[model samples]
Target: MEQREGYKRELYKHWNKGLDAGDGCDTRREVIISEAIKAPVVTAGCKLTGGSWLSPYDGVTVSDAGKLDVDHMVPLAEVHDSGGYAWDAGRREAYANDQGSPSTLIAVTAKSNRSKSDKDPAQWLPPAADYRCTYAAEWTGTKLRWELAADEAERQALLALAGECPTTTVVYGTAP
Candidate 1:
């Protein structure tokens, strides 16, 4: 557990790069995706964090990682489309590595994450009726933290979905 914690910390450091959480403006997908998969097994032996088998997407309980995916809060394509391409490999890697952080990553149902693959909120959403609010806030928080941009449609979609989870204390923060 100690070793795992150490690795998570290192990974977080690599991702953060001393930049404030919301400073990754104009990120490119080419750079981040390459780095995103480098730490592919961060939660190998660990249980999923935030929301669970009771999927916020489908409302079904997923008991295993096979049923889930560590989704990038800001999809890679969106990152690229926004401007990630101009970043150095290290920053890209760090953005991809954002998984180790609390606000940019989520262990969500395979169906939900896949359904949302590289898509902005305007393009996809969780099927679970109760999870939309948390989902929206997370989506907003992730984009804001990374300084990722959203088109008018995407921004509206997020605002609408956030109406579902009205609580403001969803615990968006750094990873342990």
Candidate 2:
């Protein structure tokens, strides 16, 4: 595979461009509002004064939206490594802001998202034991949906994780 050479974070335009653009809230805040355990008050200009969300990554219930990070199931850097480097800016932006699948973009604790940054399944898995299976499934599904290629190590790790969750279903769409 040809390397992308220099992968810049700016290559993928995220947040502020997803669903309900007219709602005054950006993709990050919008995800927070939608995933809130307790609906938050959306004041003018999409300022989320109060709300709570469950970080499935660690089962941590966060009451403040500021502490949450809207994570991509597959990080942008990781996507570049997984063949997204070949995508045009438009497709890359669409992938970054994809809310079509709930798992595509999610709200998790900043700590968890940061810790999981740019790592593939082979390098890291969710810390929450119970969430590992689901994580693997979602990770796999996201790759499949985007027609992203996983390295051998990642494929092996996913296979092992899948064995643990035989009943877990991974529903993905065709190649884009």
Candidate 3:
């Protein structure tokens, strides 16, 4: 894996009008709608007003769409460090706006998502301890699916977390 020294968030363009751009919704709104526990009311132009989201990271149930953020499971900076720096603009944009797979993006509380921003398992984990297993599995699956490489510390942390999650499993296809 490449060193994380000079990573720039701007390198990866995010929140593009996604695969369903024709619907006039961006990636964030699309994730919010998809992950909503209660279907959100979408006004014209895909403005979401009401929705309930179960944040898998902190295990919090959020009622307002404004309180949630669509998190990139493998953050853009981390992806760039792993292997995305070599990709062209089109691929990077696709990854940033990916909605083809459920694991690529998730709806979680804004607080939790910010807390986890761009940090790998070695640097951070969900505040909710019980969720670590699921978190680790998802992280691993995302990396494997995207062919991202983990550094030594990250690999160690993931291995340790996997030890605690004997029954947790992930199945992912090729990257978008």
- Number of the top-ranking candidate, with TM-score as the measure: 2
lDDT of 3: 0.87
What value does the lDDT take at residue 81 in candidate 2?
Answer: 86
Name model 2 segments beyond 4 Å from true. 1-4, 174-176
Badly placed stretches (over 4 Å) of model 1 are 1-54, 162-176
lDDT of each: 0.54, 0.87, 0.87
* Predicted candidate 1 versus true structure: per-residue lDDT over 1-176, tens digit per residue: 00111122122223232233343321222122223323223233232333223445667665443455656777666765655545456666677656445557555567777787777778877777666676777777765665566778886887666665566544454322
Minimum summed lDDT over a 10-residue window in model 2 is located at 1-10
lDDT winner between candidates 2 and 3: 2
TM-score of each: 0.60, 0.95, 0.94
Range of the 10 consecutive residues with the lowest summed lDDT in candidate 1? 1-10
Residue 22, model 3: Cα distance from true site in angstroms? 1.7
lDDT at position 162, candidate 2: 89
lDDT of 2 by residue, 1-176 (tens): 42456799999988854588688888888888889999999998888878789999999999988899999998998899888999999889888888788888899999999999888889988888999989998998899999888888999999999889999999876544
